[model samples]
Target: MIELRDVHKAFGPKEVLRGIDLSIGKGRSMVIIGGSGTGKSVCLKCVLGLIEPDRGIITVDGQDVTRLRQGSSERDAFLARFGMLFQGGALFDSLPVWQNVAFRLLRGSLKRPWTEAREIAIEKLRRVGLSPDVADLYPAELSGGMQKRVSLARAIAAEPEIIFFDEPTTGLDPIMSGVINDLIREIVVEMGATAMTITHDMTSVRAIADEVAMLHRGKIRWTGPVTEMDASGDPYLTQFITGSPNGPIETLR
Candidate 1:
């Protein structure tokens, strides 16, 4: 459903993504794993059109996204098809939970009447294990896990065809992380949506990814089914999955 071909991005003299060729099939969850500064997020932002690449082609369902003009109706339409759960919860501090969930529904082409939007937001909140009473609460009132759930609710509110989850299990306890992982998997399966997630959490990757791709040195170094990952025997992959101090990957740098 998404493809990146020979993608490259640079900031001054430093090159981040160098020929990153990757693809995620329809209705599948692909999790990208990489160490800090490996350009995992950069690749994602490039595909999302939030950051334009210095060179390459990024396509969603065969449409070249890099060519889409910012602020154009076509660009807006392309973006409307996607949902994103950022690394941080990224909720508006001023908006209530329901309004935050319904933000997209209150404006733009997907806009709906206030009553309908609120109803949709409440339903989505319930889907993410939040009670209707929680809808009136603010992000500050919720626990870390609850805030993450609210973020999840907002991402799926519009029933998007594609969802990008950045570090979905970042700050929660183990049990809460497990809960979020399971919820993400269940939601993706039920919605039959294509998913792309970037996270260092291997447990989350195991629970959520149908396929796994490892980004290294500005490229996709290894990629395969999650089932095959254990036996792949790539030194870099082994080093990362095992969290080893010594291997092909230079952790000190």
Candidate 2:
């Protein structure tokens, strides 16, 4: 459903992604794993048009989106098909939880009347294991795990065809992170949506990905099914999945 080829991006003297080539099939989950500054997030942003590539082609379902910036109509159309859960919960402290969950549905063309939006948001919240009573509370009032659940509810509220999870299990405790991972896996499989995730969490990768790609030095060092991840043979893949400090991936100062 998504294809990126020969992608390259740079910021002044720093070149983040160089010749990145990867693809995610329809209705499957593809997870990219890498250490910080290896260009995993940059590759995702290039696909999202949050950051444009200096050169390369990115296509969603066959349409080229390499250059569709924020204001372009095509970009808007492409975005309508996508839902993203950022690294942190990213909920608004000022808005009630329900409003945050329904932000898109209450403000965009997907907008329903206030009452209807709340109903939809609440339903999404339930799917993410949240109770109706949590809807009126503010983001600040929730625990980290609760906030992450709320963010998940928001991501799926519009029932998007493609979902991007950026460190979906980032800050929570291991148990809570596991819950989120399981939920993500269930939702993606049940919806049969194309899902792409970037995470350093090995557990999250094992739970959420059908295919795993390891990024190293601004390029994909290995790509294969999750079953093959442990046996990838490539030193880089072995190092990343095992979380070994001594490997081809250098520690950042």
Candidate 3:
């Protein structure tokens, strides 16, 4: 459903994404794994039109996203088709919990009256295992795991066709991470949503991905089914998934 072809991004002298070429099929979960400083997040940002690439094309269902008109009706419509959960929760500190969850419903095409929006938000919150009463509290009143659940609730509130999850399992205890993983799996399967996730957590990969792609040195080093990742024979992939400091990946100063 999403395709990136020869994508390149640079900041003056430093090049981040040299030429990323990958595709995620419809209703499938694709997980990207890579070390720090790799262009995993950059790839997502380019597709979202948050950061324009200096070269290459990105398409969704065959539409060229790189050439989309910014701040126009078309751009707004394109954005409404997908949901994103950023690496950090990226929740608005000032908004109450329900408002945050109902953000798109309140302001976007799904715009509804306050009572209706809150009703939808509460239902979505419940789907992510949060109590309806929590909707009245601010983000600061929640724990890290709760904030993650809230973020997850917000991402799925609109029941988007596509979802991008950045480090979904980060900053959570193992149990909480497992809970999030289960929730991600359930949502992707039940919603039939095409998912693209960037994470270093192997458990999350096992739980959420059908295929896995490894980014290295500004390109995809390996891409395959998760079942074969551990035995891929690529030294870089082996080192990364095993969390070992002993292989092809070297620490950058």
Candidate 4:
């Protein structure tokens, strides 16, 4: 489980996260929804220690991880338990698919022999609907959807306990987006991993989230079960989910 208490962050004159307080339950999928510049990704990065909050605490399973220094052994060990899928595929152009998937396993605390790591990588590729032949292909040779699949394969290759998905459905056609959404949902459920996803796609949220939280003005404007989201009646939540232009959430700069 993860908890953020009164978390706050700022970039000089511009304040990003004002006071974000949210929690994700064990083995549950929580989707964060918000308009652009609402600090949804910032909140996630703060929890991940990529961006340290100026104030407040972030705890993972009762341990405060916000204080953990970056590049420290403690931080590395803590982060080893998490896997992340970035908005862009973020694959290495130099490495083949299998090597990219097995990057963590080839080094660090979870190091494994080359043969074993390759076997696991191939198995993960299969789980993400990629074939063994695809493993030898470079990232440049794959389609956008295929690249995303490879990224997914890499994320789950280590069987991390917690996974963060950043805009998983971005940059894909409708059909491919739907395929990725369904795959993400199925894999999360089958792995029994705690998940936190930041996305603007309502369809993706509905398909992948057990609970939904809306971020607005750098704080959690609404939080509830996915089933109750449509009827929540919060103006911000309503306007966001319905994609309305004339609500408390301003569309214009």
For candidate 4, the per-residue lDDT at 4 reads: 96
Candidate 2's displacement at residue 207, Å, is 0.5
lDDT of 2: 0.91
The residue-level lDDT of candidate 2 at 4 comes to 92
Which ten residues in a row are the worst by lDDT in model 1?
Answer: 244-253
Count: clashes, candidate 1: 0
Clashing residue pairs, backbone N/CA/C < 3 A, model 2 = none
Candidate 3 lDDT by residue in tens digits, 143-202: 999999999999999999999999998999999999999999999999999999999999
**Tens-digit lDDT track for model 1 on 65-118?**
999999999999999989999888999989999999999999999999999999
For all predictions, the C-alpha RMSD in Å is 1.0, 1.3, 1.0, 1.0
Please say which candidate is ahead in lDDT: 1 or 3.
1
Better of 2 and 4 by lDDT: 4
Q: Candidate 1: where are CA atoms >4 Å away?
A: none
lDDT of each: 0.95, 0.91, 0.94, 0.93
lDDT of 4 at 242: 88
Indicate the TM-score of model 4: 0.98
TM-score of each: 0.98, 0.96, 0.98, 0.98
Model 3 residue 195 lDDT score: 97
Alpha-carbon shift of residue 108 in model 2 (angstroms): 2.0
* Cα error, candidate 4, residue 227 (Å): 0.3
- Per residue, candidate 4 scores C-alpha lDDT tens digits across 1-253 of 9999999999998999988899999999999999888898898898899998999989999989987888899999999999899888899999999999999999999999999999999999999898999999999999999999999989898899999999999889889999999999999999999999999999999999999999989889999999999999899999998898889887875
**TM-score computed on alpha carbons, candidate 3:** 0.98
* Best candidate according to lDDT: 1
